[model samples]
Structure formats: C-alpha cells, structure tokens
Target chain A: MRAPDLIRFARDAAAGNPLRTVLLVLAMSIGVASVVVLTALGDGARRYVVNEFSSLGTNLVIVLPGKSQTGGFNPGNAITNTPRDLTIDDAQALLRASAVRRVAPLAVGTSEISVGGKLREVMVAGTTAQYIDVRRLPLAQGRFLAEGDWRRGASEAVIGAKIRDELFGANPALGQLVRIGDRRFRIIGIMASTGQGLGMNTDELVLVPVSLAQAMFNSNTLFRVLVEANSRESIELAKSQATAILKARHEGEEDVTVITQDAVLATFDRLLGTLTLAVAGIAAISLAVAGILVMNVMLVSVTQRTSEIGLLKALGATGGTIRTAFLTEAAMLSLAGAVLGFLLGHAGAAIIRQLYPVYPAYPPDWAAIAGLGTALVTGILFGVLPARRAARLDPVESLAKR
Target chain B: MMNEPLIALSGVERVFQLGDSEVHALHQLDLRIDSGEYVAVMGPSGSGKSTLLNLLGLLDRPNAGTYRLEGRDVTTLSPEEQARVRSERIGFVFQSFHLVPRLTAAENIALPMVLAGTAPSERRKRVDQALKDYGLTNRAGHRPNELSGGQRQRVAIARATIMQPAVILADEPTGNLDRATGEEVMRLLEELNGKGVTLIVVTHDAALGARAQRQLRMEDGELRQDSRQCAPRT
Candidate 1:
C-alpha cells in the first residue's frame, strides 16, 4: 500500500479504539519522559560539580597531611595520636620543584572573630599573599598582606564578602582593627564574593597570614598545603613532582596525599556517567514492560478483529498489507507517545530546577531522538507476532466462528 | 453447448472433520457454468450450496476435485494465484454485503481497483461508472452505517463488478433485504448477466431461484437436480 493509505488506515484503526490508543500512548510516553528527565538530571549534576571546581581556581591542588578513608583532604584526619609525621617541610620541599609555581599552606579553623561589639563565629583560613593568586579572589578594598605579613608576623586580616558584612557592616576600609580569637589584627582588605564553592560558602570566611595566625594562636606547625601549577599544561607534571617531593621528604613514606583538580572532577564525571547508565538501564526495564504492553494490546486487537482480518483477506488484500496495517497502528501509537513524553520530560526538568541549587541541564539531542526511536522500534518489534497472527488467520474458520 | 464454460468443477469433494466425525459438504459434484448464464443454487441450510459457490469463487479449495476457471486448472493454483484469478475473473456478493464499515461508498467501490494497483485515473473512471450504474453516485461519500441496507448492498455490488470480471458469485445477496430491495438487487445481477457476466446466485428462496434461466438443487451434500427454466439466449 502507499504511505498515505497506510497512514489513513492507522488513523482509522486508532480512532476505532480511542481508549486503547490513549492508554498505550500514555504508557509509552511515560517511559520516554522518565528517560529524558533522568538524563537531564545527570547532566545537571555534572554541570554543578564543574562550576564548584572552577570556583576554587582550575590549576590549584589541595594537599592533605594524610588521606582519610573518604579520599578527600578533610582537616579531621590529623595524625595527633600517631608517631608518623607530615609537615610544613613537605610543603616547602614541594614548592622547590621546577614544575610548581606557587603554593599556599592553609590552616583553617571555625572560630570567633570580633570587630567592636559585633562578633561572628566564621571559618578562619591562615595562608600567604600568594593564596590570593592561587585562588581567583581579588582584593576589593585595601592592600592584602605582602611578604612583610608572613616574615614580620604582622597581625593583618582579610575578610571575605560575607564576613565583612557581619563584622564591619559594609565599608571594610584598609585601617580597621579586628580581633581574631585572643589576638588583635588589622582588617587590611575584603575579598570579593566567590559564591558557594565545593558545597560550602567561601564568602563567609576570614583569611590571615599563616605566621601571624600561628603566632597569634601560639602554634609553630604549618597547616595543610594548597599547591598551584605554573599553568594548565604543567598540572599533571606538577601533581606528580609534588607527590614525589612529598614522598622523599617523608623518607619515601607515601603518607601525605596530593590531589589535583583533574582527579577530583574526573571522579565526579565517572560517577555521574555511570549513574546515567544505571538510570537508563532502569528506564529500559520500563520500556520493556511498555513493549510487552504493546504486544498484549496488539494480541487482543488481533483476536477481537478476527473476522475483519478474514474479510480483508477475502477482499484480496495481501498478507503483507494486513500485517502492515496493524503494525502501523502500533508504531503510530508509540511515536505519538514519544513526542508527548519528550514534552513532559522538559517540564520535569523545569521542576528539578526549582528543587535544586543549580539549574537543570538540557538533555542532549540524542536523548530525545533515541527516546522516540526506541519507542517506535519497540512497538514494531513487539507488534509483529500479533500482526502475523492476524495475517495468517484462516478466513473460512474465522468467518465460521461468528 | 459449443461455447466453452467459464467455470467447471469435476468430481469436487469437500470434507470436514467435526470433532470425531467426518462430514462431506460437497460430494462428487460435477457442475459447469457458461458466460452470460444466470444460474441459482438452491438447497436446504446444510445442503452445501454455499460450499459449492465458495469453491467456484476460488474462496475455498476442494479436498479431491479438479476445478477450472476459463479452462485453467484453478484448484492447483497457489492461494496467491487463486486470489489473482478471483480478482481478474470472479466477483462475490455476500449475504451480509461484507462492506467494510469504515470505508465510504466510493472507497468500498474503489477498493478492488486499489488492490489490483489500477491507475488512479482509470480507477476513478471505472468507479464513477460503477457508482452511476448502481444508482449509488449520491451515496458515494456515505459510510456503510450511514447508508440503508439496500444502498450498502448496491455499494457492495458496485465493488464486486468494478473489475468487470467474467463471473459473479453472490451468496444469498438479498438475504438481509426486504422483498422489494431483494427484487431490485436481483434485477441488477440479472442485468449484469444480460451484459455477458456469468451470474451465480446461492439462495434458499425458491422465488429468487425461479428467476435464473437454470437452477441447480442440492440435498445432503449431493447435486439432486439440474433443470433449465428456459433455453439461454445465445
């Protein structure tokens, strides 16, 4: 039969069974929608992780005294009770490597810092002036601490956007006195808002020179190091060289952990990719079930229209024609369902945007195409047996039945 | 009898298995029909009238027989070949009319041409003539449900005759119609016969049977009698 005639046949058949058509379309559409929405969510999470990593500066690597079981540089993994030691000496040795450009030894604590009567318990980071270069934060006010701050042990402080708000209430000028814990310091500058990075607010911290923080708190040991590569090209080399230097400094004991930005981002990438496949697998099960639904519907349709099949055969319609007519109905049902499902999937992604801190990402074009294609192919594949049964029905016996 | 018969069945036997018993629907029946002959098959309900008609129409195959259409052995033809023969040489009208309900009158009439891959222009020309000849031009756009029983039967007749086949087998074509409508349909079939189309009617109505120039009577699956009502005009 010609294309237009077959289409008309499909349209008439579907019109004849509106309730079945609607139900089958709805079922297949839901399968497509679930696939699209799931893939979009996975894409959204990937973007979220990338944005968070970019906020911390792409070339920076975070160093830990040792690895925690979680594989991150958590401060709670200190070796106070153990005899094994990893220290500021390792950070200095890593800095001496040719591939390394700049490094910041950060000592962080959540403590009370006061300016006049206003006091806030905020995160305090102790590092050097290069910490600003390694990170992308720029000074919005007075100058940050020079080498003098670390060498002379000057009590100088730089508060982030959120900390400056709570302490100084906006105008954080160069020459303001602030007390951090037990010692007094000068609020030299305010860092621009870096927004939320790595699932935490960077804008809510106060940063000070490492020596000043150590002197003020009466501690001689350095904190965990933040190492920076010379450029994007040297990142992997820098990571390896730094790991080697830290390894040598610890008498070849690989206690200190060196984690690059690439490694962290890639973990999330692999995790998200696998998660997407898992979700697709789950949706495939639903698609299989929907295909079975199509098979069942087609079987019932064939049984109910037995005499019509007989009549069509009697009318000199080829077996191929009869089979194609029924299969066309199934394919049209699934194709319509796929289109509706794609629309609903976009709506579902919009809902995800409202629920998440990050905006949901659009699913790739292939997702939509594959979603619809799968539905169409599945309908044809599953509708074949029933269509063949219809085509092969014995006209004499069929007419004799009723 | 010098002109060759359009259809011939020799020793045609049809058997069916009914659970544990074998029933013979047509028993060694021999029959011949010629072009332009109007014949009626009359029998009781279980007398194999429809079976003989079905075999002649190429809708069924005999268990043990030699059936020929236009001197060719049609009983040995493949099903597809038989379908081709039916499409080209025979037309059928059923008791229920068998008009596809979803199709319009014109579509139902055009279906045979469509199946045969007739050119659109030619189908249009022939369908227009069939519609006009059957007095169905006004009801061309109506579905089977929208048309009366008689109108639907007219559409069915138009469909059957659109190919202008040599033979038309009608299985009780007026069975569902009122007497007036039945007579009108019978007249149409007789008119086709007048135009040289071999017409075969299967009916239980003796009155309808009496209109045929020849009548074949059956009882208990056997051909009981064959009589000429009058000499068929050459």
Candidate 2:
C-alpha cells in the first residue's frame, strides 16, 4: 500500500479503540515528561550554583594563607611546619603584576561593640579602600575609609545594614562614633543588605581599615587576600603572578594557595553536568517501561483483531502487508505519545521556573532529542513481536472463530 | 485458454491432527470449476464443505495435491506469490459479514484495493461506484455496528468485488440473514455470476443450493454427487 494509505489505515485502527490508545499514549507521555522534568531540575541546580559563584566577582583570584598541597606535597611537613603569614605587605607587592587590577587584604576578628547604651558582639572585617571594589560590596550611605598607606591606622568604620538597624534603629548610623574593642571610631559607611555567600553574611558585617583592625586584634597576619584581574583572560596570569609575588615576599617559600574563580566554577560545572546525565538516564528507564506497555497493549490488540486479520488475508492481503499495517499503527501511536510528552515536559519545566524564578529550569536540547529518539526506537522495537504474531496468524483458524 | 478449466484440483488431501489421532478432512478429492459457473457445495457439518471452501480460497494448502488455477500450478507457488495471485484473481465473502467494525462502509469496500496498493483517486472512484451498485450509497459513512444484517452483507459483497477478481468463494454468505434477506443476497451473487465472474457458494441450506446451476454433494470427506440443472432457477 502507499505510505499515506497505510498511515491512515493504522490511524483508523488506533482510533477505533479509544480507551486503549489513550492509555498507551498516557503511559508513554508520562515516561517522556518525567525525563524532561528531572533533567531540567538537574540542569537548574547547576545553573543556580554557577550563578551564585558568578555573583562573587568577575575574573577573581583568591589567595589563602596555607601550603595545602596535593600529590607529593608531604602532609607531615604541612602539619609540622608553620606556614608563612599572608600580610598586608604581600597584598601590596601584588599590585606590581601586570595582570592584577586590584587587591584587598582582609582581616576578620570578633569584637564587642558599644553604641550609645546598646552592646553586642559583631564580626569585624578590616581592609583597604579597594576592598569595596574587589568584593563588589555596595555602600548604602557615606563614603568608605580614605585611601592612604596600607600601614597607617584609620579610625573610620563601615557598619552593615543589620548592625545599623539593630544599634541605631530609626536614628542615622553613618558618622556616629562607636566603641569597638576599647577604641572609639566614627562610622564611615553603611554596607548594603547582601544575603549569605559561602558562609559569611555581609548584611551583619563591620568594615574597618586594615591597620586599625590589626592593632585591635594584635595580629600582623591577614585572613585572606582577594585579587581581581583586569579581564577574564588575565585571571590565570593574575593567579600565577600573585602566587609568585607572595612567595618572594615570604622569602621564596610557596606557602600560599592562589585559586582562580574559573577553576572552582569549572569543577562545579563538571560535577553538575554528570549529575544531569545520571538523572536523565534514570528517567530513560521509565521510557523502557512505557515501551513494554506498548508491547503488551499491541499483543492484546493482535488477539482482539484476529478476525480482521483473517478478513484482510481473505481479501488478498499478503502477510507482509498485514504486518506493515500493524507496525505502522504502533509507530503512529508512539510518535503521538512522544509529541505529547515533549509538550508536557516543557510545560512542567515552565511551571518549575514560575515557582522558582531564580532557577533556569530548561531541559537541554540533547536530552530532549535523546528522549524522543529513545522513545521511538523503544516503541518500534517492542512492536516487533506483536506485528510478527499478527502476520503469522492462521487465516482459516482466525476466521473460524466467531 | 478455451479448454483449460478455471480451477482444477486432483488427488487433493487435507489432514487435521485431533490430539494423537489424524483425521483426513479431504481424501483424494478431485474437482474442476469453469469460468462463470455458479456452483454450490452442500454438505452436513464436518463433511469438509468449509475446508474445501478454505482450500479454494487459498487460505489453506492441500496435504498432497496439485491444484491449478487458470492453468498455473498454484499449489507449488511461494506464499508471497500465492498471496499476489489471491489478491489479483480471488475474492471471498464470509457468513459473518467480516467488515472491519471501525471503518465506514466505504472504507471497508475499498480495503482490497488499499491492500493491493491501488491509487487513492481510483480507489475512491471504484468504491463510490460499488457503493451505488450495492444500494449502499446512503450508508457509505455508516460503520458495521450501525448497519443492518443485509446492509453489512452488501458491504462485504462490495468489498469482495472491488478488486474485480476472477473467482468469488463465498462461505455460507446468506447463513446469517433472514429468509427474505438471504434470498436477496443469493440473487446478488447470481447476478455477479451472470456477469461472468465465477461464483462458488458453500452452504448447508438445500433451498439455497437449488438455485445454483451446478450442485456438488459431499459425504465422508468425498464428493458423493455432482449435478447440473438444464435451466438454473432465476
């Protein structure tokens, strides 16, 4: 028969049993939709984490005060040897590198603060003027500490939004004098309300000059040095140059670990990519189950239509023709189910995005295509047994029944 | 071409396995049918009438025989070749009026042509003409369930003749209808025979057999008698 006629005939046969057709399509569609939704969730989680990391800063390189080495760095030596301290001088010397744009020497310590009559413990972060630019911290009011020599002490402090709201309430906080660790300092600025990052919440922080924070804490060592490269391409260069500069400052000992932001981002990206594939594979199992459903339904259909098969055979239809017709019916039903599932999956993803606006819940194109291809292949593969059974039916026997 | 019979079966034997025992359905049966002959095969149940009809329709093969159709030794043809011959030269009508329940009467009538790969435009035209000729034009869109017994039988007949086959093998074609409807269906088959299409009807009804030009009586898996009327009853 011609292709169009064959297709129409199969379509008519499928439509004849409305309940069976709907059930089969529903099964197949559910399989496909689950794959789409789960893959979207997996990819969405990856995107969310990547976006959070991107929010930290662009082209950033972080330097931590440790010789935490992998692969033959000698764990015994790391535990026994006291690593050289990362100080403001090492942070200053990094400015000489061509790829380095800005550097901030961070010093963190806990101190009790007394403002008016209120007293509370607050996290104190001490850094230079470039700290605002490197960490991308926003100021709600007033200016940051004056730019000057890194060793000179400044009595100005910047309080976070939570600190302002807690200690000053309706009263203005900027320019007010606050006593922190037995030293009175004027509030220079109030930081904007930024949510949590890594573990620290910027909304409750108090920023001060590096020298004053060192003096108050009685420490010369820095917590972490945040370095910003000039551009994306210069991130690796900035990392290597900062490490080299820090090693020279520490008497040629490579004790600091300089990590580029892209390295961390790439690691997360690969981990999440594998996770998305794993979930998609799990979802594909449902498709195989749906294919088995198709096989079972088709087997029942063959038995139900035995007389019709006999009639066709009596009307001069070859066994091959009958097989083609049945196979065509199976394929048409599968294609319809696949299309429905594709739509349902996208709709499910859309609903996810609607509920969680920050998540980019879109199924990857490859996953969608693979899901469709697998559904089709599985449907046709399972269809073979029933089609062959229909083709091999004994016409005389079939026609003899009823 | 003028001397050769349309169908010639000789020494044909058909066996059925009933448990561990073998029952011969047909034993060395020999028969010949000519073009345009209206032959009735009448026998009681288990007398091999349906088995003979099935063999004539190529739905089953003889255990040991050479069956020739239009001078071709069709018994030796491959299954595919036999199917092609069946499609082009043979048509069948069943007692149950086996019209597909899902299709409209028109689609059912066009089924043979569809299976034979007939062009859509030609299939449509021919199906339309058959529907009109069978007095089913108004019921073209009706499904088998919506059709009366006589109407469904007419649709089956239309489907049988759509391919314009040379031979029509009918197995108790009027058995499912009332007396009045049965007579009408017999007349339709007679009319087709008058138009030079060979008609072979298998039945147990004696009255129906009397209307045919030739009647073959079978007993104990063998032909007991073959008789031709001088003037067949119209």
Q: DockQ winner among the candidates? A: 2
lDDT of 1 by residue, A1-402 (tens): 667777877888788888998899899989999888888877777777777787777687777776454444434335442423445455667778888888877776767888778888877887887788887677777777676434445787888888887766756446889878888888878887766677446688788887666665566555578788988889888988887887677655556677888888888888887777677667767777788899999899888888777766666666777889899988988888888998998888888887874654667576777787888889889999999898788766665543
- Candidate 2 Cα errors over 4 Å, as ranges: A70-81, A111-122, A128-196, A206-218, A230-234, A342-362, B230-234
> What level of docking quality does candidate 1 show?
acceptable
CA lDDT, every prediction?
0.80, 0.90
User: How far in Å is the alpha carbon of B82 misplaced in model 2?
Assistant: 2.8
DockQ of each: 0.39, 0.75
CAPRI-wise, candidate 2 is medium
Clashes of each: 0, 0
The superposed Cα distance between candidate 2 and the true structure at residue A65, in angstroms, equals 1.1
